[model samples]
Target: MRDPAANNGRELARSPREPPSVNCRLEGDPTPMQVAKRYRDATPESDRLPAKKARLLSTNTQQLGTENETQTKKTTLQQPEPRRSKRSYASFLDDFADEALVHRRPELLCTFVSEWLESVESDREKHCRSDSHLHPSDEQPVARLRTRSAPVMVKARDIGGFTVPPTPSSTGPPSFRADLDDDRSRSSSSSTANVRNPRYRQNNLRFNCIHVRHATSPLPVTLSGHVDSLRAQRSSPGLSSDDLNQAMYRIDVLAEGCDEEQVVKLLDDTVFPDPEGDDTFGPATGLMSNSSTLMAQHLVPADGASPYRVTQPKPDRLYGYSERTVGGAFTQSQLLAQTMLHDRNPDYTTATSRGLRFPFLAIQFKAVGGTRGDLWVAANQCAAASSACLNAVHQLNISLQACQSTRRVDNLSYCIAVDNKLAELYISWREDSSNYYLQQVDTFVLSRPVEFQSFRTQVRNILDWGKDARLTQIGDALDVILEENRKNAAQAAKSRTSPPDDPAASAKRQKPSSRRNSKGSQSSQTQICATNPTLPEAEAG
Candidate 1:
């Protein structure tokens, strides 16, 4: 008999390895086997890996799919992937219906369906051809339609109107791979994609609507109430008329030729006093100036080559605590359980000191002579930063039980784009889980002492509110979420450990089977599973 080790050595010594049996390349990319063959051809035989090592490596790599004489392996064993936590289109529709009922805007839902149907019909007409081939003349129209649909779908999805088609299974046929590739290409061009160049107008349509609203445009009741409360706040009693005069004088002197750093220093000294410097402010407040420290990766827009890579917002002035000051302390086991259940860090989605938990305010400051263009750039930065802040709260809300009434509160975050001359206050809120809105509430000419004072007062009020009201709200919500989590754990444990039903009792307990009801219930359960797998079976029951 031939030596088994010699046969293995001969196999490993072969010039070109057999390629994977799967037909069709990935987007026309070279297969791994082809690349390996090329590398082997270029390298000298003497310089190649030792025959024993190469054989061992090949055997190890192919072990998942390699066949023994007893059976011909047709499939590789793979660890099952975790199900994605994304909510489904049906759940989105339910939320939309609920929102419409609450707002008494039933017409909105009708309009949404009509618009979607119209677009779909138009798309079908453009693509349909007698020869079953697209005409060159129709290409531009089809392209335009696709371009328009991408944003529409992104916006609709954000607002709970768009539906994502079901993803192809991993074990699906080669034909299914084509659909997956098409989806990947389509998503790349969508507004929902990770953007490298963060343009305010180009990337954020909802944000644009908020910033462009007319001065007289009515705001949401909750938002308007917060705005009014901000306006009602009085200026610092410590800041007397003399203090205002001196600050204004200093600002006027620096207004002509100050750099960004000088402007930041001037404001820090005169207008926005350091919270830590004042004993009254205590540890409740935190300030980070010109720090390029990165926030949580998921919280910010992905702008790097890798989707998971961190993006730094690096606002001029960041005002928020480094940690949550309220909420019940979690034991180690409870923290571990939370980590396993939600795949969350114990930091509550915050990464570092610059994470700025529950940040209510951010400032993007420029030099005195900064142009309107410069202010626009600052606004973009502020918008990105403010969105991250809102996202942190939204993630926390996701952890709460579905039965909870209050998951999120709006108008909790605000940003200011300011120079020595002009300052604009923008309030940030979420219409739903994904739709983030940032609207300009007020503008102030810092050159004028009255407007400057008004600006200072509003900033102070926002900080105070964040420290007290916002923190309390967040703390209460966190406690409730933790309590719900505990309850869920206990119930799960009980279900697992409770004694099995007695067979004698079970036989006696059996009732007349209602086939109609049984079918209906099973169908209902199937619908729930298909549309919302994230929902626990216990909850569904």
Candidate 2:
């Protein structure tokens, strides 16, 4: 039907290398031929090939493109859109999380500080005694030298600042022997008058009704008095010469510039050595002698003005207070004190299953290259922890006083700061109900043999004291309080059962004990600062 001349003209209009243009209706999908033609036309002329190669390339491209498009469509249809949910109340609070004051407004910070300082001063005035309170004979010696020119070295005698009086001569005058014989005969006759079972004494320690007598009008005074009294007394023998030599050998093994963790490990190994294999350190004592490096998160922070988050004290090691060590004597009282005596659980309550409990001895360690500033920081931590221990005992004292018990608790805690070069011992005690005090006892250089042995001896003695003397003191106080409580309860029940007409019963009923009436007010007096006492800083080398 076409003219020969028109066909020739169409052939001439298209180049022999160029693919033909695609022709299709716009409303529906195009045919494969049309698609191939579209792709070929859009591609560059240089990319176009002749013969079978051009046809094969177009077919492959068309097949891949179709498969990808179909896969994408299927994915889109199968997946549903994510739903939007409402925001939480906490999410709304995020905007003002950083704000401290009301509505981000500032006030007089100086006024707040001044008022706090005044409260501290007033509290100190209540219980702390003035320097005039100390008699000339009771006065403590000047502090030991801590100059950078020479490393510090001290012994137990220097630390306590007391001389042990020469042992009383066993060989006295002839009359002394005659007096002793007479006293023995009189004691034997008195023993026959009253027959009672002899109490078992552990380690021959005097744990009977023997009491430490105080003045007739004894009033609670600052902790400095307690420390000074302790300083004036003779200290007990601690580590043997052999033990000191062994510890010194271990210390000498430590290299210079050791890290903190290394120092901790070395000190622990040197002081509290692990028994080899399972042979055991003697028999199973069942008492927890020591614990180490556990976080004290349950206690309140000592530094309230920290710009960042408050830090919990994690002492390198703790000695002499555990459930087993106390024999659970304080368990019930600790729980009762949580609700009755304190605003919160006392700082000594760690609230952990296996944590250091009411630790009497705490230690802090820094790297070998640490400075005196670092040691002071460690001292501050020790002060806070030691203060907590004293506060716990002080709270018990308050409870006992309420029961009309004459017993009073006056105890001290010890802390040692150890670093590459120096070991500094510090003592902390409750000065009064509202005040506490801390003072450095002694310092020793680790590298030196003489000083290190002294340090070792002192530390061992403290550990021994905590395990025996201190434990007995705390246990006795708890037992006394429990006994008083029982007595009061029995008296209360007896009065209730007495005849209504009885004058004694009537008098008792009419006048309720002031202690019982003022129980709620005790919380106000129980408040005490757990911060370290400021120490005069020695100049850095």
TM-score for each prediction? 0.50, 0.42
Count backbone clashes in candidate 2: 3
Candidate 2 has what TM-score? 0.42
Write down the lDDT of every candidate, Cα atoms only.
0.60, 0.52
Residue pairs with colliding backbones in model 1 are: none
Off by over 4 Å in 1: 1-200, 203-216, 235-238, 284-290, 301-312, 324-348, 351-355, 370-373, 401-408, 504-541
Expressed as tens digits, the lDDT of each residue in 1-541 for candidate 1 is 3454564555346432121211332434543333444555777867855964677578777774454522543354433468854323233343334331323344544554555455444544443455244554543443424444444333223244444564545777888888989878765655343323454345443333323344467789978998999997564464678878888887888766777777777777766657655544455443323244555556664443322222246676666654423331233343333343246456654533644555667788787564333676777677677877877677666765453746654435888887777888988877645566667899988778888878888877887787677766665666666677778889899989996688988766564446567988989888988799898888777
Q: Looking at model 1, how many pairs of residues clash?
A: 0
RMSD of each: 36.3, 39.6
Best by lDDT: 1
